[model samples]
Target: METSKVIHAIYTDDDVLMAAVKKVKANKYHIGEIYTPFPVHGLDKAMGLAPTRLAITAFLYGCVGLIVATVMMNYIMIEDWPQDIGGKPSFSYIENMPAFVPIMFELTVFFSAHLMVITFYLRSRMWPFKDAENPDPRTTDDHFLMEIPVSGNEKELHDLLVETGAVEVNLVNNTH
Candidate 1:
């Protein structure tokens, strides 16, 4: 089966591009993606993207890290080798928490970073050693791009894009 053709419009000014995106979204057209050299504030909302839950995922992962660290440290220091060092009580977790702090912090950071990366990769459909899908090469270098899949009628979409002050309008093809 053939994929739908993607029509892309490149804009130089981010403000005008954002306005155009808002108009497109208001008109109920499906936006394939938007690429900008730098992040345009509120662009996700303009694109009607659902709010991300990455922060929540990170928090849960961090909690897991804390639990693992606490359990491991308690088992090793308190249970396995119960030696009172530095005039501190080995049996009291509350008293020995200061010693466990560094490891706890390290584990928290490790889990949060790893989990966030994995979540991003899964959400973006990217995998290790997989090439990234780039729609336009120049978009990575100082270009603001908006891409939309073409429906049966393209004249209005083209006119709207042109009127919205697109510097260049072009079609991207998957077929080589």
Candidate 2:
């Protein structure tokens, strides 16, 4: 566990942060976490993180929404109480599919958007009314913080971080 002697390297420029991340990985240090004010391009790749699968999950969610919309429309329009919608006799779903196209598209996008957000939140362990786990409030505004666990080479890590243009480097000792 990364429970003690973690170094919090703070950087002001994203480019410097990116360079520091690459150099740190090259040196084979395990990075615990990183917080940034905004999303940095290619930062995940620099940190050697695995690619996310959220896009695939969103596609599956969209398919479910389309299926739900199709079944709901068929039941409501054609089976339970058939109505002559738009002056056309509604006997089959395929016959009146043109009118339902808008509803189907809207539902598809709606489910994909809403469910994707929920999935991201759950995947990131962010739940309703959860207390913030941010280590530094300045990271939310204009600073970037890289957390590296100090495993018996504190002096070396401190020197490397200072060489990598860190504005401030603080060693945080956890009580647990």
Candidate 3:
């Protein structure tokens, strides 16, 4: 694949980064990516990203967990091995549902937590032994990096980024 040139704008503070993002968007420049040491509030809106649907997936996973717990408990305690407890031999699941509430709640929470993590990892293309995609290591510590694609106007973009409180600006040829 052919390599593409991108401009990397480094910022020291997240507030300056946020304002720069807004200014860049207002000027009709397509931002490629932004790397930050921590999550910045309202940054997604500024970047024009769509809302996440992870909560809906989590709810569906929790529902699946609840159904699995209910069915497993009913099969084990009622169908396969019905035991006499508290002088009652009622082999019905409804009558014993109160005793299974804790299990159901725990399984729901467990499934939601685990499945959400897996989903997030897969969606973000993260896996064990994967190479890091960050261009600057400082972005993981104290600096924020913003990437903008170069479309034959490198000097103009560079000057604009420098005017927007960027500490340093570098042109990078990214090859994947």
Per-candidate clashes, comma-separated: 0, 0, 0
**Per-candidate TM vs. native?**
0.90, 0.95, 0.97
RMSD of 1: 2.0
Q: Name every residue pair that clashes in candidate 2.
A: none
Model 2 ranges with Cα > 4 A deviation:
none
lDDT scores in order: 0.86, 0.94, 0.95
Query: Which parts of model 3 have CA positions greater than 4 angstroms off?
Result: none
lDDT by residue (1-176, candidate 2, tens digit) is 33588999999999999999999999999998999999999999999899999999999999999999999999998999899756899989998999999999999999999999999999999999998888999999999999998878999999999999999999998433
lDDT of 1 at 75: 91
Give the lowest summed-lDDT range of ten residues in model 2.
167-176
The number of the candidate with the highest TM-score is 3
Report the lDDT of model 1 for residue 2: 71
TM-score pick, better of 2 and 3: 3
lDDT tens digits by residue: candidate 3, 123-165: 9999999999999999999999999999899998999999999
